[model samples]
Target chain A: MDPFRKAIKGYDHDRIPVWFMRQAGRYLPSYMKYRQRMGIEEMMSSPDVIVDVTHDPVDRIGVDAAIIFADITTPLSGMGLRVRFLDSVGPVVENNIEKSGISAVEEFDPSSFSHPVLKAISKYRERYADPLIGFAGGPVTLLSYIISDGVDRDLFRVKRMMITEEKAYQAVMTRLTDMIIEFARMQISAGVDAFQIFDSWAGYLSPGEYEHFVKPYVYDILQELSGSIPTIYFSTMTSSYVADMDLPADFYSIDWRIDMKRFSAEIPDEKGIQGNLDPAIVNYDYALHEASKIVEAASGRDRYIFNTGHGLLPSTDPEKLKRLVEYVHSVNL
Target chain B: MDPFRKAIKGYDHDRIPVWFMRQAGRYLPSYMKYRQRMGIEEMMSSPDVIVDVTHDPVDRIGVDAAIIFADITTPLSGMGLRVRFLDSVGPVVENNIEKSGISAVEEFDPSSFSHPVLKAISKYRERYADPLIGFAGGPVTLLSYIISDGVDRDLFRVKRMMITEEKAYQAVMTRLTDMIIEFARMQISAGVDAFQIFDSWAGYLSPGEYEHFVKPYVYDILQELSGSIPTIYFSTMTSSYVADMDLPADFYSIDWRIDMKRFSAEIPDEKGIQGNLDPAIVNYDYALHEASKIVEAASGRDRYIFNTGHGLLPSTDPEKLKRLVEYVHSVNL
Candidate 1:
């Protein structure tokens, strides 16, 4: 069995399986060379480009798993939203739900929309032995981009909708939730060995607000995806409430804000844990010293996977990441 | 004694002393009228404008305390850094520490630099019977601005500096720490009853990183101001590690990410907890219902101060804040 899959299943492995959140990204020089010629949309839609980019990290950096080379907004663009990847300014929705109404999203057919990425996944699976991971943006995080039309730091617009327009908020959430489930199911059919739900913006909400608006939809998605394949939920800045929420996912990929030892103790014993070295430290010369601290913290746990708390920064040194991966693979917990 | 002061001292009060961070600026109509005529620099520097803006919330919204009206970057400008407040971009430091070096900050005499705000504090003290709260930016947060040259959501530049340039980072932290101590002491002498240190960007760091870089500087500033006046330390997205830090501030003003009941239990008994309210909810029609929930959670704690988890948004309705204050003041606990 793949070590990453075995660890998530709570089985003992020879060594801890390791992968960074954004292994197949700009930090790799190979990906950058391709990016210079192709736009994000062009690169995402091409199965050949996707296969090459996704395999680069697994082949060169030696990560245990290969996450699909697709942006979280890829599905939104497929759903007929005018999503543009502006340089530096992330995914911008030209036709936001507020301007075009929830019907725009509700009308989306996930089966028809996600074919290119699914094709890419199928091609990758045909050639690669490593477990391939597929992912979609969590409902609230997707809604944040759709409502705000871009990257909003405060996420005030979405919070306002959640607070003021309850019915409309629910409608949007329901549609997005349904779309994500379909998207996940399609990816599973396309042969993804595992899945991750990236609720990157969920940390912006209070626990009470999250309970009221986000938890039920997330619960639904996780429930739907459970048992088919191992599932992981990832979010940053959510240390205060993540442990207590106890959503029914196989694993929780946490950020660096909280300690792994304390987080492991708080969550149920059956569930596995992934993550959380601060990605910034990977840029430092003493990167392994910091990575070793995370390794030691997770040593006593029943199930653990080593990974960064957040996505790799564009400025990260690939050599450092390679060395860190080598060091984690050498550990025999 | 002021209700806020009494509550901080762990004494029983008539009601939970309620105040909102950023209470004195933006939301109020009177402040907006003033903003139309004067730039933030003019408003912050003028004793009359400062006194009037500082008193608006206490007089109109009826908060228990009066936090002075001033931007966090006011002192950076005072230290001879070329800081400017662009309409929406926030504090832009043209002569950032990276460009100007640490001497620009090291050469700063807090006593000479902070006279305008100190003079404003004195002027407000003579006329206002309400306890006035003064504040300074926390060292790491100040360095984040000084290093990045503006509002950096990630604080990656500062983090990189901390990891790669250790001696430079420590020197900057040392000088900023000393400047804050002097600034707080000057505010104390100017007759302000209490103070807050806003480490607004401290949440960007992991626990271990925070412990190494931010905690000591915060401790030094809090230690210096401990006996002089009650001190409050405010940071957002820090629920995971704030409890364990055990910094020497009289109160910890937390954000909406954590529950007040849980937070109160985790920290020291002698210390006070202020906030945990989602400020975004204050804009809703059912604001009182949300406010009541916070009051209920805080009912059991000894040293509790009712405040929003973060600053009040510019869109917050002043009427809602007034009603929320009335509702909190009516509570017996």
Candidate 2:
């Protein structure tokens, strides 16, 4: 088995499986140059360029896994949601999840996400035999972004819709969760080995709502995908509920807020664990030093994946990331 | 003794001391009318207006204590360091902490504070005869706003300066800590009953840096205000470190990220707790239903202060808020 698979499974590995959340992002000089030479819009428009950017980190840094180069909203984009990536504002979706009637939204089906995304995932996988992780947004976070039509500070619009226009929001979530489960299932069937359900905005949900609104939807997705591929339920700024969150995720990816050593004790033994480091700390000179400290912080845990509490910031230099990969490899005693 | 006062002292009260974090803001029709009549500039400028807004929830909603009405950067405006409060942008600054040479920064000349603010503190003591609380920005968080000149998605400039411009950043923190200690101390001198240190951005710091750069400054602020009045340390989005983080503050004003009952056990018995409710939960009836469940979740805890994990959003309606407040007070054990 691949070392990355071994690490995610908590089995012995030759070295720590190292991969970054946004390794395909703007931080790499080559990624920027690739943008200039290859044309900015061309990369996202073509499967080849997307896959090239996806594998760039692996070649540049020798990372153990290659996450497919795609945004969480790409599926929605295929479903007629126009998205504009702003330098400062992130994604700007002109159209939203809320249409006047269900019939109007039915025209924009998520099943339409096939040719462009599948091709890109396939090409990215071909570039490496290592663990290639595919990702999709969980129901709550996905709908929150869609309805807001862009990046929101607190997903206020989502909460408003969840309260005032709930049937519409649940309609969207039902569609999205069905799409996501299928989305992850297709990736696993398409030869992608591991998957992550990124609940990027899970901090927005309350415990009661988490149990009712979010849990069943996510559990359905995970349970359906169970045994086929490892599924990581990861959310930043959220450690309030996971020990007994009752999710069906095969592994939990956490932020630095929870003590991972105690977290391993809290969650069931059958479940694998990853992360809890502050990603911004990677920008520190003591990157290796802090990574080691974080590793030691999770020392008593049996199965663990080394990752940051959140995704990489746009300001992070890719070189430090390259150094982090090499460093984690050396220190995984 | 007031339950709020008793709660602060880690004493048993029949009920938890409950107060919404942004108790006095937009939720009230009276507040909107007051802000409209007074204007934001006038609302902040007039001590009489400030005192009125601070007292509205205390008078109307009957919350536990009155936190002083002012923004964190209001004192910077006092210092002639440029700051702005945009309608949508929250607080903005012309000069950041990095450039605001701490060594050159004079000791807080009490004369610099607006006349109304001082008078407001006095009036809250004289007129209301209730427990009044005061606040100051934790050094790093204020410095972050200073460096960014506004609220930034990531405090990269602040983080980068901490690494690159170490001496300058340290001097800024050292001076800010001194000013905060004095500012907090002045509130006591001005007759405020309790103080809170707002580390809104401290969640951005890594545990290592949080322990070193941030905690010491926090310790100094808490230590300087020690025995004068009880102090609380509030961090937004800090669920990962709920159990392990150790700052010298007397209370942890936590967010929705940590479990309320489990969280109560994590903090030392000597310290009190302020919150664990998700403000977003108030939007949905299910969320509202769950919000009440969160109060029950903490039913057995001692020395707890009931509050939203963070400030109430501007969109939160007063009717729902009034119900939420009544809900917390009604069933709290």
Candidate 3:
């Protein structure tokens, strides 16, 4: 099997198919210079720049996969939502989704979504030969910005919608899921090696709601991708729901908060498992030196793709990450 | 048994010992009216108002327990390094910790830490006469905020400290642990029914680091609290580490991402367990109705206390919460 295929099988690759959550990030001095010169909006807007930046870490650090360098909110930008990446104040929106916006949802066109993404995908495919993960925000996540009136700490606004305006919430979920299905399908058609559904905040859903509101749409998207592409389904703090809900993805990248032994035991034998190391462990110098021990602690007799509980922070030294990579390689069973 | 004592023992009460993470807040009309009258700065300053608001939910919502109303950043506020809650951008610290702020560390009097908290205890002692949880930020949590450098999407600044400056991290950790030890001690001293260490960010620390930097101190704190207070070592996603480490905690509050069957199985039976609910479930229209299903799922367990995976969001409706309460009460073991 292809190493990438082997990777999705939960098989330990010859050199552990390791990739940082945000590998193409500020941690790369090269990317910093690009950010300084081009600015985030300019880079995101230009497919050429997106392709160049996407390959920055793959070619440089030599990881197993090259996730397309794009923000989770990329698809939603077409919906007349002004998502501005204000240097440091992460992906800010001018208008948080209010009842006004929800009622007017049909007025927006899917074509209005950003064009640079398609251009970037076509271009990035040409640049990096490794598995390129095409991903999108889960339905509820996109709906969060809409409900919070902007960005909120606990997503109270949307949660309220779940209780009060169940139909509106369902309508929003249907819309975002439809968008993501198209978004992800487009990537596979464009010849991306593998696709992963980045449900970064999916764990927020109860199993029943996840199954009702989310899984069907995600399953639809995966099917639209033609199922030929090896796919990874990832979420944070979602151990309970995923166990009960049958998702068709090849891997589940969970946060480190899960009980690994139980997760390993319960998740169906055929599926792949990724993640979840404590990203903060990098903060402990001892952790940098002892990554192998950490892996050994979480490892079980299953296909485990070693990754962090969450994204690697900006402060993580390249040297520590390098050490972590070597550490995972050493432990690949 | 005293309901508070039952809370410590991990027994589900007749009403199932419910308390909202931030029970008293902007959501309540009464809290808003009181807070508006007193002013925001004076709200935190005056123990009277804080205590009154702490008891507000008990009077209004009929929650089983009342958590002391306070900010996670309260302890760090006194260091006089210019910490204030901003109207638009919550919790503004004008001064990010340089080495100079560390100098002010010695001036911190841990005994005085819980004085206002004691005042809260005195104020509400006879009112509800149930479990009154007193909370403080745990080590890594304090490190995340006390030195609020930037958006800690993944706790980078603090993790970098742990990696590069073990001594510095330890110094910070020791001070925080000492302060918390003092804080928790004071809460215990104040005749509060139980204690909850809000290690909201504990899931950020990897297993090894958690075992080293976090657990030992937690063990010591629990050892010191030593059967006096029922403790809940609650965090978002630390189940991976909690399964491995031996901490002297009476209970664990798990995130909803974890499947309860696995969580219940993996977490040793020596201590009681609470939580592992999907917060998004709370957002569903039949949230309380669905929550009863969740409680029913976990109902057979002898040592489980029911709660959400995390706290309620600011926008969580009173009706949904009321439903959750109704459902938990309706569940049959």
Candidate 4:
């Protein structure tokens, strides 16, 4: 069995599955070369380039999994939204769906959407021995990108719509979840072994708000996709909602705020756990020391995956990342 | 006795002490008039201006306590750091001490430093019967500003220094705590009723890291000043550290992430609690509804202070703030 697959099942594997959240992105020299050669739109649209970039990090850093190289906002573009990745500003949506109104939010057939991503996953799977992980933004995060301005913008319209326009909010959430389910199914058919849902901004909502607005939809997606593939829920900054999170995903990928020992005790052993390493500590020596602390915390747990609390920052040195990966692989749990 | 003081003592009061964090600044039109007339530094330097701005929210909104109008970084200038406030960019430091090295850090006497702020406190105390809150950024936050660029900057140097340069880190933390003690004493001497230490960035560290690097120094400051004045520790982000916090403060002013009911149950009733309405909810009706939830969460506790989870956003309307304040004041419980 694949090391990533075995680890996700809470089985003792030959080696602990180690993969950085953004191991496939800009930090690698090979990725930078492609980025410079082609604009973002061109590179993202090219399936062959996506295959190469996704494989580059796993080859260089010896990670246990190869996540498909695609932007979270790419799926939104599949729904007919005009999305652009600017130089330093990150992703920007030309036709902000929030202002366009929720009535404008229509579900698209994921089988017909984001062909490049599906093609990349298929190609990567043909070559890679490790599990190929596919991912998309959680309903709220994807919805926030198009409707609300950036993550920090007072989620005025989104929060207000959640209340005043409950029907509209429910419609958008249901449509996004359905599209997400389709997106996951497409990736699974494309030969990916796992799926991870990135709810990067779920921490912004209060528990009651999350329950009312986000949980049901997230659970709906996860419950539908559970038996098909090993589903991982990457919920950031919402450690306080641990007890309240009733999602049926196989794994919960928490951010750095959580205490792994306590989390393991609270969560059932059958469920797997990944990450909680602080990505902000950029110094190589400190990162290694912190990684050791995480390993120690996660010790004795039946299922544990080594990864960062968030993405590997652009400024993060690839060599440091390699060393961290090497260190985690060398740990004898 | 002042309602704020009575509430802090966990004594029964005629009304719940309602105050908002970041209450005095940009949200009010009267405060904006002074801001438009002079730059931030000029306005902050004028004692008469600070007094008027500090009282404007109390006069307009009828909050229980009057928080002194000042920036958390104001004291860094007293430590010889070149702190400046720019138009859109908030606070900037010309000679960022982080680059200057932690060895360059020094403690300054608050008695002779920031005369305008002290005079403002004195002036406000003479006029207002309510308790006036005096604040300083927690040691780690202040140290971060001088050493690192901003809150978002990868805390490479600070995190590294915490581990590698322990002595230097301790020196900086010790000097910061000392200076904070002096700053709080100055405010206390000027007749402010209580002190609030804003550890806005405390959420960045894990429990072990926080315990090793931050907890001791913060405890030292609060312990030293315990009897002199009611010291409130307003820690942000790290709610997991609630079980670990050993600081003896009159109140722990927590952010919105915390569940007040759980927090109150965990903490002793003799200690007061303040805060945590989410400021991001922009709709007046929604804010009031959320405020009612907070009140309910905080119900049955012997002592509770009503306030926002964080600072009031610049976009938040003064009218909504007034209504929320009015609603809290009218609550019978």
Top TM-score hit: 1
Q: Per-residue alpha-carbon lDDT of model 3 for A1-333, expressed as tens digits?
A: 545557665555555567768878887888788888887878888888778778877667666777788887777666656677765567766655563567544433545554787778888777656777777776677676555444653555665676677787778777777777777767676767777777776666655567666677777766665457777777776655566667667777777655566667668877777776666565455654555654664455445566776677676667767776766766645
| Clashing pairs in model 2, backbone N/Cα/C closer than 3 A | A257-B240, A257-B241, A258-B240, B96-B146, B97-B146
Residue range B233-276, candidate 1, lDDT tens digits: 99987888898888989988899888666776788878878888
TM-score of 1: 0.97
The candidate scoring highest on lDDT is: 1
lDDT of 4 by residue, A217-332 (tens): 99999999989998999977677666558789988898887676666666776778898788766445867777787788775677888888888877777777788888888888
> Candidate 2's residue-wise lDDT over B109-149, tens digit each?
66556446667898778888778888888788887767764
Candidate 1, residue B319: how far the Cα is off, in Å: 0.9
> Model 1, residue A83: displacement in angstroms?
2.5
Q: Which consecutive 10 residues in model 4 chain A have the weakest lDDT in total? A: A148-157
Regions of candidate 2 where Cα sits further than 4 Å from its true position: A37-41, A77-88, A99-104, A107-113, A163-166, A299-302, B10-12, B77-80, B98-104, B110-115, B283-288
What are the lDDT figures for the candidates, one per model? Answer: 0.84, 0.73, 0.68, 0.80
The better candidate by lDDT, 1 or 2, is: 1
**Can you write out model 4's per-residue Cα lDDT over B1-333, one digit (the tens) per residue?**
866788877777767788888888787899889878888889889989998988888889888888888888888767777777766777876676666776566677665686689989998888777778898889987777777555433355567678878898888889888998888888899998889999887877776678778989899889989999888888766765565586788888887766666667667767778887777773458777777877887856777899887888887888878888888888887
Q: After superposition, how far is residue B249 of candidate 2 from its true place, in Å?
A: 3.0
The alpha-carbon lDDT assigned to residue B234 of candidate 3 equals 83
Candidate 2 residue B100 Cα shift, in angstroms, is 5.2
Q: Give the DockQ (C-alpha) for candidate 2.
A: 0.52
